[model samples]
Target: MEPTVASRPDPTGLNRRALLQGGIFAGLGALVATAPFFADSPAAAAAAPGGPEPSAARLKLTKFKDPLRIPPVLRPRGQGGHDELTVRLRTADVTLHSELPPVTMWTYEGVYPGPTIETVSGRPLRVAWENHLTGNIPVTAVDFSLATGPSPDPLSNYPGTDGCQEVPGVAGLPPWAAVHLHGMLTGGGNDGWMENLIGPGDVQLSAYPNKQAATTLWYHDHTHHVSRYSVYAGLAGLFISRNAEERALNLPKGEHEVPLILSDRNFGLDASGALTGRSVHKVEMVGAQRLMRPHHGPYTLVNGVVWPYLEVEPRWYRFRIANTANSRIYRLMLLADGRPVPGAFQVIGSDQGLIDKPVAVDGALNLSPGERAEVLVNFGAFRGQALKLVNTFQGVTPGASNQRNDLAEPDVMQFRVADRKPVTRFALPPVISPTFKRVTPEDLPHDHPHRWVVLVGPGSANLPELWEMEEIDPAGITFPSAGIVQVQDAQGAVKTLRRTAMSYDEGRAFTAAHDGVETWKYLNLAAAPHPMHIHLAHFQVLSRENYDVTGFDRVTRGSARPIAFKAASVLEAHELGEKDVIRVGTAGQIVPGPNGTPGELVTVAVRFPVVGRGVHHCHMLEHEQHMMRPLVVSPAAHLHRGGAGGHH
Candidate 1:
């Protein structure tokens, strides 16, 4: 819900009133068109009066259109900019009800777990996104009622391709969104061009700065307009950035180091367990509700499975954990092997990648949306006990009773350590490290070749200005303005237009891929603290801004997301390390790389690479697809790069 609103309608006068009618009440002709603002939650409850019998999770077909597929992209890994990615947007049928969603989703590449992306820092990537839509663009309420009733599970893929240049599991959709690789240090050139979210027949290209501490990251739509709903309907995948520098660490490899991308979803199906289309020819109301676990699902999933199990041997293991939930935090812990056996958690990396020193924690690790953390668990002592990785984050959520009551339910998995251990043993070292590779000020010819971008959100006060500027596009009203902005009250038949910046101050206009170091801050002014994760480079939280109490003595308040964080990575350290995304805490103050030291503020010490560029932006899928800006990273040395799109 980035601040993106129009005072009036686009050249196509589809004002808030029209937008609401289409999204909530379909086929209402004129009566439903009378009111502009959408029906609030109470209204949704009122619309349904008394919901159907409170049943356990069931499968349904929220959308059974087609698949959103894309081409497999392979770019030569390096410390430069963007690699190449070919993304296709199509539609498909999906059956997911059981505590997932009642709404349809238009994903990048079809399937629950979309396609995979791999690149190196500095190697910019070019993704050609082609969108194809069938039903209404934003998927109005009318488009969903097509389902007669609910049915069985195991949803199926769409029918024949119509020769739709198919790409395995991915297809396309109506509403379009550009890809944003959250956390990459690339420039605007490779950044996910969120402003370019198109409809059928539209295409776009973007890049990134793949330079950073080598690690695993992710990519998703940054279209803040439909952020929540879009991602809830499935539109997220992983970004793998490898660096040759850290290979000597001798960390877990092969099956030892595992990447787990976790998400929660519910589907919609018909009474006969069929792929029910969008709203029936006519619709009533369309919106979000808490059917399963209230605001978030009580059931936890590791790599899309409920209480999935994993077998672990008596050795060191690298676990990459990502919290992809729309709004759920996991306080994770490993039920260490019995006291007889030696057991402890070693911290190798964080949201971005491996940390310089591996810290030790007794138990309980936390993970938030769009955040990634890498750690090692030693099972030498409990070579015989049955251990489990669990989430003790009970009260953290509102309605977690369902998952809390079932210990095995909340239990992520189990580990059966091998009876004997010998080869390749690992332990928490006082300081784990990486090969630093940051560029010096001298390396960057221009004294001020750096770029300064901010994450901005236009408040309710800026709707008029936004409309006046005509930045509003043709797509119907997307945001709650259903975003992180002040929810405006609709008076009478007129609706207020207040735009919010999904990821505030996205200075795409200013971050056109640079040739060296870069620094930017995600300044959020909304009430809700968002998890700001970047791709490509692993940046440390340099400093936090202290806020004074407001109202009392004209004061403000201080805030911090993932509040546990102390200091962030340094300039030289992050430059040479391998990291994709960094968790920009809610403090609203983000400092890239190590500390800025004296006389410096909001500066990220980024090093220029010798190859292509990569992308850097928010990982929150929905936030990215809408209006999040793009960034590009270039090299210091003079050179010409062939503007080759991801063609083949």
Candidate 2:
């Protein structure tokens, strides 16, 4: 029998108590452990008609199963931004080494590493994200709240939680996550707010208004605590937003335009394709073998093929590249004439969207997970020549809080130039689209009404007498969910984070629309630099505020503190108009906070979708679901459509 979406936990088998301790731990532990393995792992190796190695067996990894075989481009689903775009997620089993049994996976239409979503920028789009699972986050009934007391996390449990979370549609899995357009102006309320999770039988609304930045934006699971697990467990993919204006640039269109989704994964050759991981500190890993994909792996897959190959025409091609790997960073380089293709890709856009001008790279291109780039490559110059796409992110030395860049040898795929058929276009446009303006600190437009929100991390709670715990909880979980983490290298500076089930900020809900204009600040107390993001809307970097004040006193003495902005280097960051994601720098370069982390970042104005609903959370899916999800949107025409909880 197939696994039902929402089956009651073996009611006849066991009552409540036992399910809580065993099922919850087993389910969460499995989710957390299996995540990193699927980053770029592909489904079973189909025959490579025109490809590289038979399989990337050298690198055994996990990856999202490709979504149902849907065409890349699709029509808008909702009248406004909440339309439904159909995406089918399924799973299959794969054979492997040893006498291990086959591992089962919840796949995308039966294939790993789901499909790419191609659409236009500025135009509203909806995605009907469907979850068809053989198994899921166990459906056991378990309470996920912090044992007690108010969570000091930046996020508030009740704020963004509309009402949707009550129903558990999928198996007992934590509400994994929904789609969040990485770098585009989208709606706030339905922006994949972490709390608005969906299940097998249930559905959640992901609505957003497009600011028309006309750039490359992507979609991935943004669950707070489970982000590292979900994305790693094969729940990530691509999104392309285009605009009429961008079309006029004479860039590659239709077939010539390609979206190269990059990712990695590690899977056990046995057990129906279930993943296995050895965390740095999971109490279980002390004896188990849950390794990070980077630390291991011999082969690489491009578009779901180990050392895969592709056929390209000798003409100017627009490649929308997305690095969907959970932990690996890929420094992409085209190997032309044996050696690396020197300065091949001229990057035109990044995570948020288009860069003001195109920037060319020599030898290699570095891409971190969740990062994307749009480039123009003239295949005409290298027609008939075989190009090997190589991974170069694995250069960093192992051991540390930082992720791995050791994907260099993880050669993704190959591109062969068939004889160039005569075509009108010979070269790519020197420039893609007209430049977008950047909002500066001085004289910015005001949003409808603004409330100061602080991006706080659970600090002080993690502080201990020894100054540094040789072994600390990774995120404060037990057993398979190792909670021990390495402390930041601040030396003797006291650092403490409240004991948390998850490491992300607690979400706080906010309702009220900023009629198309408003400035907001994102203050961060977490030690790490989080790539902060919001759906349905693009925001400007108004200024960065760093205050040395702490506690209630900081807000009280706020008038004395000032905010400032630095010249952003990331070309795409200068959005003359609105955008999706913004890099909120840490405290001090622009401002300081007495809490030792970033205090606040003044943001540019934004416009909610016509219906007004979207999500605002950390771009890092792992952090968002755990505790970083929030619901902030404009006044809605169909407010009651979603309810106090949410659409799901």
Candidate 3:
């Protein structure tokens, strides 16, 4: 049966017109004052826990019935020192699965997952991102008022009409777009600032220097407040940077190399309980508050195909895997005949570039949202066998009672190895990148800057907050002081800190001197894990420690001194590589100190080579729209004659 839109009553007692008119959750201030943290709101009382379930039409769809789609490579107009290209953002009707009908989506160049743009390192590539979108945005179930009430930041005002004046005639507002090249080292003007939005008929020209090492980077919509909706409507693509250093390795090329872009979506149902063929933004009730949580559906998409399968030759292949999901964290593993494949994944690189050496991963590889991994898999051993790539990570909605596994997909995709003889065997290199060097504290200058960052949540209406921390003297600190937290320093001495900046508009609290190295400590105080991403810089994980989250008094905004300062195990081989995004405060078990705490404190070292203004925030698109802040890198001060100060 073909999926069609039904004229059924809205399940959450909120219709499309009402949602666009900003009727639902309009009285957010009143709801936050009277509602409990986990209680159901009147509007969503009839909704099931963990939001709505997939419709009957969607549930009947089979898994791995369709072939995987490889996004076409985008051709550049010119070559040599510089290249120019134009990418159009427009609406298209795409058939996501064979079982479902064609759904209208806002895509880049009229294709889902867009097209892959490959470039040579050190070359300058200029792209004109043109917006040609028409009509209302494809996503309808979004909560535009979630971050509305009583926020000083202008970005917090969702569906704000001020920014929509350019594009008229659409319900609520026309689609706005700001293309961001994730993990690229570029100037602040071309970095896709969140508020640099362009409506229909507008164009945004960006130039990427591509001076960083060869690696995998992606481009996605980054409009403030509406990014989650735009990206979900299909506006993302991969940009690969290659150089002679990486090509000399001869790892995998041509048909042997593949790009796997992973994403998830949930379809809306009509009045007849049939699929509407439209992506739905899920909403959950947490005690008198209707909160629109991150969308996680039963359908899993790989390169725009739902539960797709790939036919691989009986040889070694390179896979560049990227998790583009808004909020899902995939613990990916390879299995054959329902059993684990030992050393299936030989990871060679991370987000930024190649690691020092390839690490064989016999277990699962944890990939958080916005994270990417370059893995090499050998299919020669399993020539006639079919392998399955699965996600073992079970996701849980924050504050939702329904811990239903059905809502989260376990099966990602399938790999059917062809039954054929090997053409030519390639030996795996021990040292993938001979030039790669690990960053250590000894290499940094003495008195390098150290910054503190904290992730806290449920501040107002269950919203998550990212805070810039300032250290204070513990001499006269009182216990249970409001907005103050006590933690153990690296020397096992007690240190008091206070939250400084919580909003995006807050003046830049983090500053670094050009060519200077800095260390940052991220403390996760919230229940859920946050993939903290720093812009325009690649960092190395210095250390990780466990903390006592239960000791944090949310009411008093204070925390106990005992953060259980103990050294964690050595960093994972894949983690040794440079990364732009780091998962903080995961639920995984770590080495605990005297007190078996449940929080995480991660420390990382970064060297700022680019002088510009950029923003850092959680990679989860929903959280990023609300929890983001600015960072600035300034020119180093001139040294005096015979002065002790010098560039690191």
lDDT for each residue of candidate 3 in 350-435, tens digit (9 for 90 to 100): 98999989998856788888989999999888876678887764243211112232233466778877667865668888889988
lDDT of 1 by residue, 146-226 (tens): 133311211111111121222221222346666666666554445554455766787766545455557767766655455
TM-score of every model versus the real structure: 0.53, 0.58, 0.82
RMSD of each: 18.2, 14.5, 12.9
Kindly provide the TM-score of model 3 when superposed on the true structure, using C-alpha atoms.
Answer: 0.82
What TM value does model 2 have?
A: 0.58
Query: After superposition, which runs of candidate 1 have C-alpha atoms over 4 Å from their true positions?
Result: 1-110, 119-173, 198-213, 267-295, 336-344, 384-386, 392-431, 437-528, 533-538, 544-648
Q: Give the Cα-based TM-score of candidate 1 against the true structure.
A: 0.53
Worst 10 residues of 1 by lDDT: 462-471
Instruction: Summarize candidate 2's per-residue lDDT along 1-648 as a digit string, tens digits.
Output: 111112322211112354234332221011111111212223322321133333322333322122101112323433544444556554444222112233344444333444455565655555566655546642111112233432232111111121123323333454345555565454445556555666666655555555556766666666545555566555655566667767667677766776677655443222433333211100000112221111123334454443444556677778877766544445566767556665578777665666666667754565545556777777676765667666543232211111122222445666767665645544545655567555564545442445333443332332101100122323543322222221122132322222222223333354545444555544443333445555555565555444332332222211122222223323222223244555444411222244444333434555454334454555443344433433456454433456752444
Identify the runs in model 3 with alpha carbons over 4 angstroms from their true place. Answer: 1-58, 142-171, 289-293, 394-407, 489-491, 587-597, 638-648
Better of 1 and 3 by lDDT: 3
